[model samples]
Target: MAILSSNYSLESTYSLESTYSLDSIGLHTGLIKCPNCGQFHSNAMAPHGHAVWADMPKDTVDLTQDLIKMGVYSSEVVDLAKTLTENQLKVSLSQFFRDSLFERSASRNRLILEQPDLEQPDYELNSSNLVDRLCLEVVQEAGGIQAAFAAAFGDRQGELFENTIKTGKFNRRQFLARVLTVAALIMLTNCQKDNTADLTSDSPNDLAQKLEKNQLKIGFMPVTCATPIIMSQPLGFYEKYGLKVELVKMQNWAQVRDAAIAGELDAYHMIAAMPLAISLGLGSARFPIKLASIENINGNAMTAAIKHKNKVKSAANLKGFTIAIPFIYSMNNLLLRYYLAAGGVNPDRDVKLVVLTPADMVIKLANGEIDAMMCPGPFNQTAVAEKLGFIHILSSEIWPGHPCCCLATGQPWIEENPTTFRALNKAIIDGCNYASQSQHRPEIARAIAAPEYLNQPESLVKAVLTGSFEDGLGNTHNVRDRIDFDPYPWKSFSYWITTQFQRWNLMPSNVDHEAIADEVFLTGLARHLAKKLGQTPPTVILRKEQLKYDQFDPTDPESYLQGQIKKHGF
Candidate 1:
């Protein structure tokens, strides 16, 4: 007597790839049988050219109307209607409406009283099989037999249920039965819930399964350098592709680089210079480190306090001033040294180099403790906003376009969990794309402002999200344009690192930099994404190819100067 239906059409060709079909007799019109399941039911399989109760697409609404007439709240009925299918709608509607009929009432009552005899325990059920059990429970609770039959087989409940009963396993009857049972429980409970459960599921195992089993702990030095990776986590890109990312913040690049080399950290928002230093054992560690994904390039700026603004314009103006940088071998040092030398001033003699952390650089500049320092993003924005100082030269202004920050994971982590690496890489790429677009700026800004990381005001967040860089020079520019977001050019950067290693005596003169870069970043999961997405991937720099050291090595002290000359016909 339970009405079931479908949206299938008799005239339409069925996509029988996974079709389920059933047959049943109608309770009301006395039709012995009908094609109620699959294509036939959804396609208007009704008698006398009139549609069966559940044969129509909008049958659920009609059923809700019947429940409303029976004094159910319109809202509550509508809520319940969400669980009801077209056939279930029609069958449930017909049953309740015809409950007033004496003959049908007895039949409905008898059907309920004569519950089917128990069968042999051929099927086993457990927590692992909860979905199947829950499904049946749902069907039974959904108005019991009628609801179950109507929801699954539509008007063909007799045939569908009979077949399923014979099979004694998963079939339309079992699936519908379980679905209705759970839905009915939910409806009767009328449970009020909140986002805590809805937004994030209680299944930690399931959530964890959504990410890679292995871990990659990348470090960041409070500077805005780690923006890409941080942006990826909140964007759900990391989890979508299965990556367990541990973002650790370090106090300085020294710690960041040290942790990376010691394997205490898998990666960090690394300086192009640091990778070179690590690959060659330059400043501290002698271990060769690798670069997987370049996070950003050329947003860094060399800034000075407002009081020293008049004392310096370019490196030439700093003839005798004490200039502060984050560290001795820091990118700030290399860039300033290279730039001052390019401008014809000896970095070792013309300027007294003072070393400090990025945070200290800001404080010192504010307190007039340091003359100028190289800083990035919000810090620079903060300093400039407070009238702290003007930027004598930004990396993007001096170097124009070059790689700056990178997602430098340890070589060992990259070897395992290749899938996870690809996922993380894809997420980082997606996050960068999201961050770059103006329309997505607000979304990215809101995400950064949230508590997970980089908690800042909306305006400040957007300033960085939009890639704006202002060095207090009264000249603000979009820094993203000067950034090579995908700077995986293995040879370009690897050779540069190798040369720095040799220059700083960190690596042997003949150590294969290109081979090391390839082993770390160029191979593995990232390649799959590049192929799948049709992206021109980051090039794997290798030692086999001749190094392009003259083009990028800061140790040459005149590369940028030569670059400026080459571009301007100097």
Candidate 2:
């Protein structure tokens, strides 16, 4: 019997006369050639009178024939066929599929595929509409058809599927049969557990007992400085440490602070000075935050509007102009202030410093709302990419080897989950080591540029990470140290940051900078982890930092601050 009529034009459908001889297969039998595999298989009825193929292995076909003798419909054999096909599907489909197959397989049979109730809503006879209905019926529980396509195939294949669907490359019969086959395959496989186990010397139960938490939500902003934290998810660094981490992309520094304070984020990517600020309750409630490791160093730049290319040649020229900073507690603000103070331009009185998200800073600069912006990459690179601004000065020029961002967590959470914390820090340190290599920067940029992470153009991100970029002034500069990763959390960095706070009058003068720096920056932990990871950390925690205007001795931060006050007259 003919299972269903083909909803395809005569020119599109394969000619049975030339492709196959009907006399050999017998037309009356419910058998048809699968256009996908070119193998004959038994056909069954699907929703909307579509044909579903029972394309099983020879042994499974014999088993189905045995069941057929017992009066079972061929549709029941479709389940077994699906199981075999799903087993043969490649694992590189998508991360979603791997997670779904391994995590939610036990409840696979319960997946309810909702049928479209609308009859002839967009022309039922249309081939495109027929395939759309088939997709809807199969993947309705998986966030509709497009999401299913993404989960079943990675980004590249998903795009191909979209293009093919749009161009109506597959007729209704071919598309419906494939959809039914895939749907059945996934449904059956969902009931089975993945046999491959990734374990260590300790048993599963022992490992689970040792770690207080294996799952965590790490918050991060969409900036290139958070490259290590963001790339760890896609690169399997977190998985290597036996962690199931969900990277929550936050909007702004304030949102990250609020989320971390509210206990919504177990850990987060924070500006180097934020831990000190949060611990002292400067801009947030008293939350004892610990700096695990410095994420990136010197990944910031002062970008000015294109029109101000010649007008704002130096920091002194920035006087009487408005500038944008990522946050009040960020290195962008501190470094910009330091650079301006050295140029005899008081950041507070000379240039207006407005707080804005990095993403919005580019827009505001393009709109001529802000004359300049001192923020982290690739926003500065983005402005250059769009020809809205030119790189005025890199933060490395202001203070070489300055700590830009850090990986931080609540001190209480760390104490509660010590083992998990160690594992998490190890993963972050590994990611940092990976990102430090100049050869890996291009790959790192591509991995983090996905919509879930930085969500910027790949070319723009590559330019920032690779340190080969146009400065929007017809100059291509290649500076490898523009952004570099080092996991060490130097106590000297904290001392310098606190000294800046004192210099800017952001913190009390008598606030025990040494004690706070020692308590907030986990230098000891970072040193230990770095050594354990086979990386040589600095033997001493204190070091002298040379800035554009003056030198900062960590051992004598008080003297440095007093001298800064004497020099800049702050």
Candidate 3:
């Protein structure tokens, strides 16, 4: 019996002059025939428990063939040997064979021991099927491999695994390697005990300990404006910062608002103005909600039915025609009203403004229930894709960098869970920075277009994010800045939204816009986090904004609103 060391190379062949008996080598007293030579050889066990021929062959191929004839054949073993030979890896064949056989035997024995009652008529008892069943059971127990990866590593790593699998980057061998690595990590995490002394300050365990709540439910509507919030889940931003977030899909803004107000959601995605309105108790019972960060900027667009392309080129032609706005508190409503008034069409009186959910907008326009819709993508883009509507104007065309949607959480929740809130804010801001890059748009579109998120066609979502699509007017446009993201919760945005709320008679005339803006915006926190993340946030809280027909001075919001009222003849 020979014992192979780690340095024993398979390239070197050795012939033993002395033969060992079966009892001395722990063999089964059998003579196995070499398939190639048609000669019977005494089989004996090596020191490492591998079957070895007493009279070994001089060639590696003949040794491999003999092993195969002795019932030690497995694709993995053969493939590994071939790979090692191709790569010139200095591994001993005997050691490799022993380790592979040991692992296989141990795995089979463990599974059989764990599931003793294996006499089912339909169940296959083969080792391959048993291993596959075990793997599936483990994955199911961990709520699928993606979720398990998220739990063991983070969301971003999980997303990488998902993409790798989806894009065929992982061949069978590479996939098995990754699965084994992730499984090992998951087992280690599960076996870890609570020991603060072993944890670093920035470790996930330490951060989780500091958080008031690690698990949270956040609400969002399936719109492109909620890109940062929606993409954060699938892209792994949330788990990157030590959070386990479950995104609850809401039907509309009203449902989102109600859920936030009812304390059913830990956080939510909302229009930029909703925190102010909710804080002021304008739309719902007064709830002190804080805008953690702006989710997206300039994603809204005005889309009109394709049939009205010639008849309704401008808002002036929209008089007496019914148009849809997602919600009264949304930027869609304010910007649409602003555009209509600029075109000498009073949105309130000259044209009927109806509140319709964005999800129903395209269908409503197609059915002739509404003439136009002012909403977010991919609904606007979906209209164009289905030939129901052509984009009349993008909000960016009206205001180049207008704030649209925001990430919000109740003030009380923030107060109780400040650490968790900061983590959540950082995750969302990271998502914003990621989505702000045009290169990531298509990947984001594919990620969020699944049934759990947007539930829209991938092409429609891709067109909206990539900003390259047909306009339903015999034109292909590539407007890269069509929808953009900025996480900074600018106070000027709040002031502008409040002014619009008052301009449309949604809020009282005497309300303190500046004070409400200061209370709800959380600009200081946004600035701090933005700077922490290596972003250049504005030095001041307010900045002047240029609109299509007018400009806004945040320092003199009242005067700006008065000028707007006078210009529109309000």
Better of 1 and 3 by lDDT: 3
Q: Please give each candidate's TM-score.
A: 0.54, 0.64, 0.65
User: Per-residue alpha-carbon lDDT of model 1 for 1-570, expressed as tens digits?
Assistant: 122223222111111100111112222342222111101112111245455444433433233234334443333323322223223333333433334334443433211111111110101110122223323433544446456546554566444434433343333333333233222222222121111121133243454453335356767765555667776667765655445677776777778877887788655677766665676566775665655566765667777778876667566777776677776555566666657655666766777788777667778888876677766655666677789987666666655555567766665554444334445666666565555556776686677566556655667656665666565767876755433345343344454544444443445556554445443343323333443445554322221222112344322223433464454332
**Candidate 2, after superposition: displacement of residue 4 in Å?**
85
* TM-score of candidate 3 relative to the true fold: 0.65
lDDT of each: 0.50, 0.69, 0.68
Instruction: Show where candidate 3 strays beyond 4 Å.
Output: 1-203
Which scores higher on lDDT, 2 or 3? 2
Among these predictions, the greatest lDDT belongs to 2
Looking at candidate 3, the ten consecutive residues that score lowest on lDDT are 13-22
TM-score winner between candidates 1 and 3:
3
Per model, state how many residue pairs clash. 35, 0, 2
Task: Compose the digit string of candidate 2's lDDT tens values, residues 1-570.
Answer: 112332322221211111122212311333443322233455442223324224422343343343334443334333333332232222112322433455555532211112322111111211212333334433443455466666555555443444333333232233333333332222223221111122233444454555667888999999999999999999978777677899998989999888878878789999999989999999779898989899999999999999988887888899998999989999999999999998899987888999999888999998889998998888998898888999999999999999999999987687566667777887888899999999999899899999999888999899889999899889999989899999888777888899889889888888676678766877655665665677776654556688887877665677788898798788
